[model samples]
Target: MPLTKEQVIETLRQVNYPGYSRDIVSFGLIQKLDVSDEMIRVHLVVRSTDNNVAQTIKRDVEAKLKEAYPAAKHEVVSEIQEPPQFKTTASETAGKEKFLAGIKHKVAVASGKGGVGKSTVAVNLAVALVKLGKKVGLLDADIYGPSIPLMLGVDEKPLYDGKKIQTIEKYGVHLMSLGFLIDNSEAVIWRGALVHRALQQLMSDVAWPELDIILFDMPPGTGDAQLTLSQSVSLDGAVIVSTPQDVALIDAIKGVQMFRKVNVPIMGIIENMSYFVCPHCGERTDIFDHGGVAKVCAQLETELLGEVPIDARIREGGDGGKPIVAMDPESPQSKVFLEIAQKMYDKIENQ
Candidate 1:
């Protein structure tokens, strides 16, 4: 069988963009492909501050090709490049039907990698804002993993207020998510294009009432959701969340750089699970090792918005569908998120 460029490209499509469900081919990450009977060569251009991204892509490309052609020689070249500004400035959205148009402030709560409590912070922060008497809406843009509905304890589908779907209110905050629209048990098996379109509909298709601000619980990674938000909407800023560890901080730093690269102001970073305090004994333990966020903030020149300790109360509240901030605003467990929310809202307002 003769090796062909088409076959090589198709095989490469199986390689997903490092942290996302999408492929490199769809993202236009494959810069060049050369195929012949003697050898197969591929060039990939990854636009990420994380150097590991390029290596990961190159490794995946080689592995796929090698599996397909065991006897053929292969060369994978990866180019690490900085992407041009990928955001729509406030000026660009003027006179345009950009989503987030009427809101006083538009913000995205994001993390490059998941499992660092990004969505947790977003949920608590939104509740905190409402407690502070700010009209707020939360859009669960994590189409693939919509948790807003579960975390906020809203079960019913959003009722239409005429032509547009009305946001389901919970804990005094307006909330919308695909999780609310579909069966919670059913998985959202969507491609990148569908995910992109869904985000548009989530933002522009629905009727979000005029409010002080809205926070987008962005999906993890620099994929479709982030791409759609950065290119189409005018975001006031973004709040990055991470754990107090090297792996999480590395991804968190990449997230901060991505927002900065696209001209999105980083409101600050929230070190979630920053530390764990003993319930039995009054002792503090750095479960994931502390002080990493301070170093990250110093290196990135961003603010350490606040630290959220690892507490059972937070988890219990989230799982129980009554976040601590809204349930007990005066509790210490809730104050971390509240303080961060206050800082974010005040920062965006001052801007």
Candidate 2:
């Protein structure tokens, strides 16, 4: 009723690594193979930091083993074996240095809550950076609701240029979103591990042309998925987005704390929808109550980058697939984004 260790190893042996032609089990990377009635447990070692290939192998092996041995349940635990110091020769060292490649800086835009205009800020910030003559890339790592494609007005799928996936270009900014890979009508339902793999692909599988900056639109939360993300890449900094509401400010603090826990710098905080400007009277109102984020940032001894007023035009512009900053470069809302962009540049450049 239980699969023996040899059968487990042989089953894994049939699954091939995508980049490498070798089977996983024969590579001597399979360990702790155990079997019980109707259950299979195993551990796998993936040497090197090539997470993309390792994940692919893991997924394929799991799917195949479950299909071939339909009556049995299997669970595989995997770990990456760090490459030895001496094995990293001069040439290898040079190759690995190209991880971020041409990117001068990477900023992750995150929030503690959803529907707080986190993606909107991320999209506008990337556009703002491009407007300032910097080559930019906006990676929509928000695996669940990837609205970057919708915000940027690019409905076309990215071109696969032989070796790497080419990011779709729009508004002078290279764009990549999970939305580009799936049908617009479909939904992405993935657990934490799957989300991590997808994020890894977006970071490593794609060829982001020499970029001055790359903005990541991270998913909302402080869950394991977000924790795994913080551990994976070396972020230059993170900009937490929040509204003027007290609950939102609390979550924003948690976002800042998460980055601080992982040693990533908190570039600053951006207050979105801080206030509303009446279209009919041109009067400003603290719709959500103003200065909440700025006060919080001050208490934490961090910078409050800038405040984005709640303007109907900004919402309209986003829904219409043209970010407010791009649609009306001279508008008041646009000015706020521009100021935030300038301050962010100064902060990172000084570092």
Candidate 3:
């Protein structure tokens, strides 16, 4: 039989910490504790500044879990969360005025690696926000793989006045992507300096007149492209996307780190393809095994925006050049996307 939550908590209590009376589970360090079909997954958070204790806790947790449940498939991830510290007014207010200019707020959509549907989320999110009567703009910063144009069905090239580049509007949202300018057959090969210049030009030169929210479809990975783009743009926050697989989470953490290093507040995480739903019987299957993002979010002490299940319609809509949110606004999946955008707006505008 599969282990219960009670059994998991009991086993954790047996694993002690150095010079501490409370156990790992009781200290409220364990989060997203889940068990299904003899498979176990959980995350343990420790202070990143204290390297010795963090390593010890990780090893102790892994060894204890294996001894208790030898036959079960287990995955335990450890994250180091540094408690928030107060900063002086000078540092905190360095770029606040410059960052919030004509745009009310700017959010970057990022992933640890490619092929996690980061661009798709960016495109549909901008559209969803527009549907809610918000003036939204989508900037595709994935220079190499600029998919925003194709995703938004914008084929015609953007018109340019002498001074600034005009934004192409589709589905009530201003959009700009490298895919619109560059030849599909050609490639964009540039180094960090050049790439940074290109992104800056896109942001400052584009006439994205009076946007309530601007979403940058950031390139995947924690490479020069991402670091440069984050530095050049006055970002209000970031939204991370990841799959439920462990490999995806590994990359997702790198993304979170990059944003944190740049001091961009992480709005939340969205777990795409969290699970697969059987349409016939309305049954849910843990295809990739869900809760990976939730576990990581709890470890990092960040909000979980929401989870998007793997559905045929999502893929079909992308392939058909029609976003699900624009095609079927009344569907449950569309509702979830709208809710995420709304929650983001509340976080930025209300605060």
Q: What are the per-residue Cα lDDT tens digits for candidate 3 across 50-162?
A: 56667788788889889988988888887877745433355445544454268878889999998888887787788889989999988898988888877877789999999
How well does candidate 1 match the true structure in TM-score terms? 0.75
**TM-scores of the models, in the given order?**
0.75, 0.71, 0.77
* CA lDDT, candidate 2, residue 62: 82
User: What lDDT would each prediction earn against the true structure?
Assistant: 0.84, 0.80, 0.80
lDDT per residue, candidate 2, 1-351, as tens digits? Answer: 445777777777888645334577656678678876588877888653456656776788789778878888889777776423222245644643545667888888999889799999998888888889889999998888899988888888888978899988888889999999988888888987888788878878899888889998999987765765566665789999999877787678678777776667889899999888788898889988788786677655688998898877888878878998888888888888988998898888898
Which prediction has the highest TM-score against the true structure?
3
On the 0 to 100 scale, the lDDT of residue 138 in model 3 is 86
Off by over 4 Å in 2: 1-98
- Would you list the clashing residue pairs of candidate 1? none
Question: Number of clashes in every candidate structure?
Answer: 0, 0, 0
